[model samples]
Target: MTTTSTPAPPRIALHRDRLLPAEPATRGIARELYAAVRDLPIVSPHGHVPAQWLADDVPFPDPTALLITPDHYLTRLLHARGVPLADLGVGVADPTSAQSRAAFRLLCRHWPVFRGTPVKLWLEQVLVEVLGVDLVPSDDTADDLYDAIAERVADRGFRPRALYDRFGIDVLATTDDPCDDLAHHAALRDDPGWHGRVVPTFRPDRYLEAGLPGWADRVDALGEAAGVDTGSLAGWVDAMERRRAHFAEHGAVSADHGHRDAVMAPLDAAEGERLYARARAGHATPAEAETLRRGLLFEMARMSADDGLVMTLHPGVSRDHHAPSRERLGTDIGADIPVAAEFTEALRPVLHAFGTHPRFRLVVFTIDETTFSRELAPLAGFYPSLYVGAPWWFLDAPDAMDRYRAAVTETAGFAKTSGFVDDTRAYLSIPARHDASRRADAAYLARLVADHRLTLDEAHETARDLVTTIPREAFRL
Candidate 1:
């Protein structure tokens, strides 16, 4: 007779209590504080969740599609660890026809790769809190976790609107292109049964770039969307104005721009008109393209002042860093790479023109961490119209968040910052990311309280600000 081996028991609890303060007195205080604010509603003022998900109210297809396909954060990290993109069902490959189960099993096998990383923490939280799954997912339990998740996702309760309500999200903002018609947004607004507040953010990257190969066609689309002829400089400007008005009618309170650099060049009307003609004719030289883009950015600032839409600029990303990948998959598919950015000098033209103006509000973001104190904080400290955006992209993790506060708070202070924006395409990870941010912030504040630098009362208030007040006020939620 042969004896069978016994499997180890899976960890069932979140372990948050131990992961947080452990000293008896400190633990009691943290538990009490966390209890009071643990259930506060989430305010997501900036993100990339598709509105159609809510409008259509359809169940997500499968484990791979639901969790793996749309999350670039997960895919990029896995790729960094020598995992091929095709194995994760990423790139332009057909995930639906491929062996999704095998791919998901591979991810589950490599779950340990996420240990000590933010992704692991967030996934654990989502699993334990959101799905109520206690068993740790590994190769041993991969099939069980996948089947459970897929089953729950097939239910109507897991649809976008239901999850939005269940998650207690107070406000959600969805980013949209300049040429978008926003029909789904209108549908949501008109639906009496849906009470969730989902708003649109105007992102005009395609329209702003004059050097793109298809700029003329994109301009024509913008004109058609706005019902204005964009053949002339004046007409193109009018088209942009019309589109902004349309976006405002859809409850848009912010306009976002993702550019290669934050440099702003203010051109006189004649110069602007000349550059516009070149761009319209598809004959613009590199210098002319730069001049036109800068001119348009200045005009966008003026429009924001007039329309009361907060302007957010994300710069220094060298888009399509992998040329072959871009040729195969187009933009925003994990090809964007960060570069060193200059804020003080690059933004001088726009700042000098409108930085002190009360009507204008500009929030700037950088992937370069070195500039946080040296450039961003100082600029935000002085410019009334400028505020430093939260640590973005690769810097959204826990340690980076801590470094951001440690570096910027001394100079820019809390008031000069715009709080946090999740900026995610993964809808399920929202709460997890925010939870990590809150914990990291609380830990930082606890240190301040411990060192006598701040009172506990002040730390509590600051925690609330970082979570709720700042995003609401900064994004006009």
Candidate 2:
């Protein structure tokens, strides 16, 4: 059997009206609205791309390392198809090893599995628009596709800072540990040649979770980093305050919370201190740890209220759901599963305490779409401090985004909702994801115009606001 190396690949032209309404009249409105905001500078107020990628300004290694491995969106699907992660370069000692080429080949072979999925759309967009690679990915074209991309990656023009500039990103916020010194963020900001605005966000999940292994060590490390003692709950709070202040001194405007639930029922300070003290001494039980976690969440809200860091909370996902996979490959390899989340009752304790506090800004994200119209939108509708976060993580698909807009608009309207957030670690997908968001919003706004719910002018304005003004305001950028 002979392999056909020069097989004709499908043309990769993107439709001008993709993701817009199918009806001619409404589609025309969506087309105009999308064209207006399609090239708007992306205001990425919430994301997971590392500041170090830009700070180093290094050329990306290869296609697999750049596109496949770091992106759980791609890897999880491939893993589900029984393509071992190792073959996709998941946990290899060297990403440049032979496994990378195999990974790319395997990925191309399995590309059809990504059909009708947002990941496929994003990857195709990246390949066509971002990478400027001409061929569609498949077993027939994998080698040439990989070689062409590898050549581009080897060029200085394809370096992180260069791509950051090319992406037209106005601002990028990265998730950072509270204990992180944010040295890379500072370096990027301070570099005379670099002018991109990259900011840090305070994330203290490990230190706050008392039941987790290495939580004690993380607490001690936070104390060391902040020059404060973590002897008690109050001292730990002090340490957290110092770190938040430090993050602010750099460029942070928000603190991100990722937990199984959004608990804010405050315990007695003394009781909370006792719980922490027991944990510090290795005598804390699981129940005590749960108490400490909730109390710490309450304390965190108070701290946010006091210090004015926008509190962005998301719950209802069981992280690292497959323990065996997580243990073998480490965490965030995308084995997590989403569960139903209760925001109304779960957040009452915190909302009652700080919902009206003028300084506090609470933005809540959820994978559980069930809560949007029923619980989240209504809650955000009333709370001055609460803003409904954009459909994020598992809910960033096109239909999900459309559903999100329809769900939240009735109660919270456009202003009370956090605008599109590209919650991704895949750096190049920033614009593709943002583009998907703009098109989705344009389509939604066009429907409102067609239904006589909003004027066409109003819909256009809302589309622009969703792209720029709303994200800036929600994250307080």
Highest lDDT against the true fold, candidate: 2
For model 1, residues 1-477, the per-residue Cα lDDT tens digits are 999999874875777663355566666555555555567888888899999999989888787877776777787777777777667777645666346777778777888888777778877887778776777777988888888888888888888888999888888899999899999999999998999989999999888799988998999999999899988777888988888899999999899998888887778888888889988888899989988998888889888877888899999999978887667665676768999888898889888878887778898888999999999999989998888898877898878988999989999888778877888888888888777777767766766676678888887887788778887777777
Which residue pairs come into collision in candidate 2? none
Q: Count clashes in each candidate, considering only residues at least 3 apart in sequence or on different chains.
A: 0, 0
TM-score of each: 0.94, 0.97
User: lDDT of each structure?
Assistant: 0.82, 0.89
Best by TM-score: 2
Candidate 2: lDDT over CA atoms? Answer: 0.89
**lDDT by residue (tens digit), candidate 2, 1-477:** 988797568867777788999999999999999999988999998888999999998888888889988899889999999988777777676865467888999999998999988998899899999889867778988999999999988999889999989999999999998878899998987899998899998988898789999888989899999999887778898999999999999989999988899877898877877888999888899988988898898889999999899999998899988888877778888888999888898899999999999999999999999999999999989999999999987899999999998999999999999988888889989999999999999999999999999999999889989988998888888
The residue ranges of model 1 lying beyond 4 angstroms of the native Cα positions read: 18-33, 91-94
lDDT (0-100) at residue 47 of candidate 1?
A: 93
Residue 25 C-alpha lDDT in model 2: 98
